[model samples]
Target: MLTYYPGKTFLHRLDPTLKVLFAFTISTACFVFANIFVLLGILLFEFLLALSCGLWKWGLRSILGLLKLCALLFVIQILTYGDGDVLLRLYGDWVITFEGAEIGLILTLRITASALPLALMLRVTKPTALANSLYRYLHIPYKYAFAFGMAMRFIPIFAEEMAEIMEAQTARGVELDTRSFFKKIRLLMPLCVPLLLSSVRKIETATISAELRGFGLRKRK
Candidate 1:
């Protein structure tokens, strides 16, 4: 689920620290620019740079996902707190303020603009490279860094397990068609229980292994 593709893009060539700095700088600019037009200009520039790095399709898809999430949030905000001018009053008196709608839109755009480039950076940068860069620049402990690396690696493992479990249940004539949402959810409980148990066991084993290996020991030299 989380793997990097090798490429000769300039982003791939830059030092990891520089790439992170660039992402942080862009994120800061997004927050600092209160005007939507200026924030959009920065987002457009980021899109161009992402395209230059040979990941245009990936970047665009991620940005679109952000847009959808933001749109959903805006809808919820309008429905719940919308008042003044009265864009269809619901249940009586609860109104969506024009100011509130504008605030929501600006906030959504700012968050999306800030997050998309950082995500793109993650997509292009490998986990090992990121961990090493963090260790070198931020003085992060290797144990914690390696744990983060392992956690990212496990995402696909758990996903594959879930898919296999779903397929097995489907083969066994378990109708998960969701005609009854609650029933389908109940069926998922069995799968979830075992998965949770396995995850707990894995965590316990890792902790014990770390203890045996003197993971907390500092170098005497």
Candidate 2:
């Protein structure tokens, strides 16, 4: 699970605001430095941080997905932003240029470095603690802080619901994993109906519960 895991790790013990500041600092640094080596170092640091927090598996999964995105970005960047010496020839006049590849690699590294810290922070920090920290330290409105926490908590719940829906569909002979792109897309269409209905039901229930609890009745002091 990518959600918070109760643990005795250093990251788990850190102040929520401090962790948020650290993530912001690292993300800013990633954008500031265009050097590939610096970005690689930051990337390595993120992996090490994940390992220290016992979230290496989740981090690895995120990295794998990002890598595929980076590969596609590399192609797009090379084709659209191609300049300087040609690196590789494609069909006809198309070619991958050195400048394009360089820019693509840098952008990919920057994105990875920027995202991993926040992901790790959220995975380690409980949403309630985060909300409390925002309310206490940052003096944010209680309703907004609580809403942020609830939103974070719902992410994994929705993912689990979607997984269950997929499994049920698979058992009923829906071929969601088909190689044909359009066929797979067509198969996924049925999933939207159930997901949308469930989402609407959840929203309604939440709204009613919030009203009963007087969510916005009293303003934060």
Candidate 3:
């Protein structure tokens, strides 16, 4: 789950606005530089920084958790990049090539490089602090800031719920393991309705609570 870790690490101590800016800057750099080496360097730099902050455990877990997604992207690249030195043939008229593989690797690295910084930041920074920083420093409307904060807080909550749901499904003999990402998605789609209903119920409860706490009165002051 991508949630804040309570610690006095450098990233934790850094201003929330600065952390947001730093994450965006790194993410932007990842997209701007298409070179695999640069992407690797950026990723390595992020890991080292996370390690220094004692948050590499969470960062690595988040990154490794996404390897399947990266593999899917790599597969897409191999299938679509029709022209290059033929590397391997999987079937009739479908093949892998050196350039395709290279491009796929770069595409994979690009996405990973873009995502890790933001994920690491979320781990080290509190959602409330971030929202407040956005309001206090940037003068964003209170409601928008509150929405952002609540979204950050709930992302991990829903992720945990989904994990539990998947576990429950597995216990019931739902074969969740599959080589094809699309097949995995198809298998899991049935649970989405329940998850969505749960999310709506939570949102309704939050709305009631917010109303009781004078949610929109903050803008008056």
Best by TM-score: 2
lDDT of 2 by residue, 159-219 (tens): 8888888888988889875689789778888798898899789878987898898777876
Rank candidates by lDDT, best first.
3, 2, 1
- The residue ranges of model 2 lying beyond 4 angstroms of the native Cα positions read 179-183
What is the C-alpha local distance difference test score of each model?
0.76, 0.87, 0.87
Lowest-lDDT window of 10 residues in candidate 2?
Answer: 74-83
Model 2: colliding residue pairs:
none
State the local distance difference test value for candidate 1: 0.76
User: For model 3, how big is the CA root-mean-square deviation?
Assistant: 2.8
Clashing residue pairs in candidate 1, if any?
A: 82-95, 82-96, 83-95, 83-96, 83-97
RMSD of each: 3.5, 1.9, 2.8
For candidate 2, give the lDDT. Answer: 0.87
What shift in Å separates residue 198 of candidate 2 from its native position after superposition? 1.1
lDDT of 2 at 27: 94
What tens-digit string does per-residue lDDT give for candidate 3 at 1-221? 57788899778999999998999999999889988899889988988988977877866876776666799889999988878899999888888999999999988988888999888888888999999999988888978998899999899889988888988898898888667867889999998887898999998999899989988876535
| Better model by lDDT: candidate 1 vs candidate 3 | 3
What is the total number of backbone clashes in candidate 1? 5
**TM-scores for the candidates:** 0.76, 0.91, 0.85
User: Could you tell me the lDDT of residue 97 within candidate 1?
Assistant: 71
TM-score of 2: 0.91
